[model samples]
Target: MNKASTARVTLDPENWDEFRSLAHQMIDDTVDYLQNVSSRPAWRPMPAEVRNSFSEPVPHSGVGAAAAYADFRERILPYPNGSIHPRFWGWVQGTGTPLAMMAEMLASAMNPHMAGFNQAPALVEKQVVRWVAELMGYPADASGLLVSGGTMANILGLAVARHARCGFDIRQDGLQGAGKRPKLLVYGSSETHTWVFKGLEFMGLGRAAFRSVPVNVDYTINLALLGEMLQRDKEAGHLPICIIGTAGTVNTGATDDLESLAAIAREHNTWFHVDGAFGAWLRISEKLKSLVAGMEQADSIGLDLHKWVYLPFECACVLVRDAELHRAAFASTVSYLAMADRGVMAGGIPFANLGIDLTRNFKALKVWMQFKAHGIGHIARVIEQNVDDVQYLVDYIRKSKEMELLAPAPLNIACFRYIRSGMPDDALDRLNNEILLRIQEQGIATPSGTTVDGKFAIRVANTNHRSRREDFDALLEAVIRFGREVEMK
Candidate 1:
């Protein structure tokens, strides 16, 4: 048994007053942290001694929950990867919502196992699927499931596509042993998440199996290049298998030309999959829905509620057009599980047999609660504000002599870099790296770097809802100041 479980068994949850008091203190502390987040440093400069303290050996005598709680408050919360801070314009991680935290507490209390229909947890999973399908404008007949986030969802979606094309017997036998490896081809922009490569590897499709397409000036996928690649692949006797389009890219927030990509996939009679891990929320905003145009045409779509919907930890949704293929890919005959007809659920679809995960957690409760507590319009406005904030940064970066745009603002991500005046190309690269390292050491902001067209650039992704015009202003000022300091040195 795990240490927490063994400790819990000995202490038991029955010491009601103490545990309740502890929980209240923890909640209050978190609320305070969120309220005062703007004042805290975006990141910490942990000393080597402080870092080594965490590596201390475990004690034979157990510490009480109260002590552990105090340690968490003192040590852990302060040093979190700093995703919640407003000036943290690094990667695409999302901030957690307070309403979702309450849902997490409630879900933990119930501890639902969302594998089969006999359990209440299974019903929770079913409801989540219905919510996702309805949100995406899919028919009530769709099938879906919550996973550990976009990577798993992509993997699951590819598994479903493979099974649907190959049939259920392939699951009984193996992929190569059953027949020739279907001349599978997947397409996405060069900016697509690395998770797609991982998904391909897990599915027995080597990394080289994918065809990376080019991007246009706005950083969106170049549909012309994609069409050319597909046509060439077909002419070369290569089997075109699937098209993976990006709904929101991880780098500069570039969306693939989903409308054109879908049309191309349709012409080739290939499976269309949209990786909308963070960007699909645009569907809620009529103004931004055009960014993900043609997403509805996807045979399967992957979305991350944790990113856009502001749920805690990792919760991803994988939706498929055909419900039968979902069950055919992942279902097993377990005597302990209830066997119901595919479409026989009462209010909506039951999602138990939709994917590979069986003993899933009640992750949907937090997302459901957050959606109900905060209307879709409110969240859409938050996203719109983030986009505006990024645009503000874009304007500031354009005005700065030291900074130049690597890619234009698309959605909420802007890629730019600090350029040294009169410095050689290689020297400018070193200067930019030095500024980034200096800015990180200062701990006022946390921005990351990426290569754009073979040049090192800083990526400012405005995903946190708390980010405002002032936050962007501060970040721009910091970048300019750091660039000056690095150049002077």
Candidate 2:
């Protein structure tokens, strides 16, 4: 037998002492890492040797976990995408809050498997479902399940939408012989996250099946264009299966006109799906809620708890307006498994029936703890502050002669770049991307890049609550210094 099997063959854990000690060390090391990360480099230029280390084969025997831990301390831990660093504005990812971190520890300790109603995890996830529903101003009866991230949430939501449109029997009989193409059509803004395409691919619909609606200057879907397209599609006898509205697109943080999109969906009887990955928290702020007006009109909504909520990694919720439709998409019965009718003690409203996952993690506890510790108002204020900071940076960019705003800073993400007076379009794009690379190599900050109307621009996303006005000022200084140096050379 293998060492792992041999160790676990007995009822008790054979190396429990060693394992427990290593776990304690891991926790201590992780705590130290998180605490000191603010002072550490925002990123590190990984040498070729270290990159090659990751390619080596696994050591099967004798190499102690302590040795493995040493390697981690020396290498892997130091080199991340710098998500935890306050200066790392590269992506929409958020640095988890301390409260959420502690809650994460507790969650790991409990290790609830939220697959079904028979487990304690079910109750915990149920609490999350209720909380997410309430946040969106929906009824507490709304059903949902926690998934890894926005990608999984979108996949699950699309699956439910498909089932609702095609009927429930698809789950049992499979799509193998399912009649026709079902004319499955999905709608999203041109600026929608690539995950929209990823979800379509996962759902067995090719990228060609989706219709990308035009976006306005702010990068939000133009509702008029969407309406015209919908009318045209209906006239062509095409199925208008689903309409997806973004509450904060990844690129520019522009929210589609949700109320208008919802109205259009209702008029045509199309399933409305909202991918509110980072921006759904706008529901918490009455001031920002107008941006996502009519989000509740969505038949299904996807929200990432990790972002904005500052929860630990991999927690997203897929909420459906009709719980039964969610069930119809994912419900199955096996003779050996605990099967009960809908609404019984161990039966109805089971989260497992709402999504693809069966052996799910207890991602709810951390989010729950965060909300309890920091009230909704505190989060709203933080989000508002982030918005203000982004606006401040936008103003700063506008004032600078060397830098220019590529687009109006909307929400908390601004896309801009260093202006090159005489460079061609292709050359300017390369220089801006080079600046992004150089910034990462310097290990002070890691800003991203995106294209706006065929022009490459620096993408700064203010999703971290830790960012202050000083941080924004420093970023501006860095941009100016870097831009001068790059242009001179």
Candidate 3:
């Protein structure tokens, strides 16, 4: 007997009234934290003592949930990645909505696993996936699965592509089983997100399996160069398995020529996969939809709801045009998961057969609630506002004598560098880096750094809906002030 002396026990609270009181307090604290976030630093370094707090050995007994909430409030919420702050222009991150937070709470309380299930969660997931696919202009019958984030979504898309093109049963026999297989390869611009390459590697397609096609001055894929590479690869008897197009390159937010890339993929008889991780949500913006034109032509696409869609963390989806191909890539015929024609299993659409994860979180609840709480029209308006903010910053940068715009202001990223007359490239690099650290250390704003066309640039990604021109103005002032201060030293 595991516990002979224990009272007949479950994890449920002994007193519902007391538990409800605690829950209400936590909810209020969370709401206050989010509502008042703008008043705090975009990010702050955690103290050494606080860091040491986590070094204690794991305990066999559990602390009460209320006590745990106290630790989270004191040690965790104040030390977040700062992606939710109004001035956080570092990476392509979404500022989550309050609706998503409450929805997640309900999802946790339900505690339902969505893989291979016949339940309400399965229906919600199916409906949300359809809405997402329709928003992105995919066919009504297309197949999709909720995944952790963009990277896994990309992997799932590529896996389907790999299976379809290889013409061999990759599930039964991997890359090696095919005798004398041509060096299978995918093509992408130099500016494609690093996640694609990471996906390729994780899928057993080594990094060398990707061909780096050059991009034009505007950072769009150079069509002529892409044509030449495709032709040359065919002539050399190598397989062009897929063409990976990016709707928004992370460094400068440059969208590739999707229509042109689609044509090339068709001519080459290869799969066209788009990694529209953060930028695909540009579909929400009527003003910017033209930039991602022909996104509908992709055989598959990877999208991150957590990025531009403003959902909570780690929510993304992959949609495949061919439902049969997607199912063939991942479906299992195990005895326990057999489909039924009646009773509990009859009505539910099996989710585990669609992707890598068999036991998946109820990610669809947050997405579904988001759509129901704030309609797509409201989301689109916010997207349009962010794009306008990017343009506003670009205009401000051009008028600033001390700052030189390094790349074209495309989409929502503006790459620029601080310049003082006659500052050598080497000296400018060092000074700008120091300036970045100084601004961050001072908690003025958080903008990440990147090399734009071989020149170090301060890369500002304005994807937050909470941002306004005043925030951008403050960011610029901090950059200039820090740049001048660092130059003096």
Which candidate wins on TM-score?
A: 3
What is candidate 1's lDDT per residue for 410-447, written digit by digit as tens? 78888888886687767767777777777667777788
Which portions of model 2 show Cα errors greater than 4 Å? Answer: 1-24, 167-182, 340-349, 487-489
What are the per-residue Cα lDDT tens digits for candidate 2 across 345-367?
35533666677766666778887
Candidate 3 vs. true structure, TM-score: 0.96
Q: Mind sharing the TM-score for model 1?
A: 0.91
Expressed as tens digits, the lDDT of each residue in 239-311 for candidate 3 is 8889999999888888998999999999999999999998898987788899899899999999999988889
Per-prediction backbone clash count: 0, 1, 0
Which of the two candidates, 2 or 3, achieves a greater TM-score against the reference? Answer: 3
In model 2, the worst 10-residue window by lDDT is 5-14
Model 3 weakest lDDT span, ten residues long: 167-176
lDDT at residue 383 of model 1 (Cα atoms): 86
RMSD of 1: 4.1
TM-score of every prediction relative to native? 0.91, 0.91, 0.96
Ranking of candidates on lDDT, top first: 3, 2, 1
